[model samples]
Target: MLKSALVFRNAFKILKTKYLPYTKELQKVGGALDDEDWDKIASFLPFRQIFYDSTLSFFGSRYVTGNTFVEEIYDIGYRINRSIDDLNDGVKSMARQMKMKFDKY
Candidate 1:
C-alpha cells in the first residue's frame, strides 16, 4: 500500500512539471525592439527569431544589466523549471516501473 501511494505521488509530480508554463521564447517575440542590434538583447534570451512592431519602443536596457526584480523572477523561473523537470522525470519513471513489476503478479 505504501509503495502504491508513493507511485501515485510520483505520477502527480511528473504531471505537474509536464504542464508547467513555457513561454520565454513566445513572450520575447512580442517585446519592444526591432533590433538595430538583435544580437545585443536576444543573444542571452532563449529565442531563435525576434519580432517587433512599429508601436514598440525599446527601453534603456535595465533588465539585462541590473539586479532588478524582473531579472530575479526570470532567474527563479528558470531554476525552478530545471529542478522540477529533473525531479518529475525520476518520479514518473519510478512510478511506471513499480506498476509494471506489480502487474506481473
Candidate 2:
C-alpha cells in the first residue's frame, strides 16, 4: 500500500532524471556539457563518435545500431562497467598463476 506508492514515486523520479531512456539536447556553453569535457568522458562510451544536442536525437531505442546505454546516474553505471577491465586483469593474473603451476608439474 503505502510502500508501493513510495516505490512508484521514487521510480518516476529516476525516470525523469538520469535514466530518461534518451536525451535530445547537446552541451550548452558553460553548461554541464562541453567539447573538452565530452572528449574526456564520452570516450568511455562504446560510440566511436560522440554527438550532442539534437544532432543525434530522434533515433529512440536503436540509435547507434547496438548502442548500449548506461544509467548516467552521476557515473555509478560508468563505474560498474569500468570494473570489467579490472576483472579481466584479475582473470589474466589467475591464468598466469595456473600456467606457472602446470609448468612446475
Model 2: ten consecutive residues of lowest lDDT: 46-55
Residue 15 of model 1 has an lDDT of: 47
For model 2, residues 1-105, the per-residue Cα lDDT tens digits are: 333434365454454367434223322333333334434333333321222322344244455432233322223333433434443454345445544553465
After superposition, the stretches of candidate 1 with alpha carbons farther than 4 Å from their true spots are 1-67, 87-105
At residue 1, candidate 2 shows an lDDT of 38
How would you encode candidate 1's per-residue C-alpha lDDT over 17-81 as one tens digit per residue? 56444333334576322223333333323221111211121253434434553454454344434
TM-score between candidate 2 and the true structure: 0.19
lDDT of each: 0.37, 0.38
Q: Per-residue lDDT for 18 in model 2?
A: 74
Where in model 2 is the C-alpha error above 4 Å? 1-87
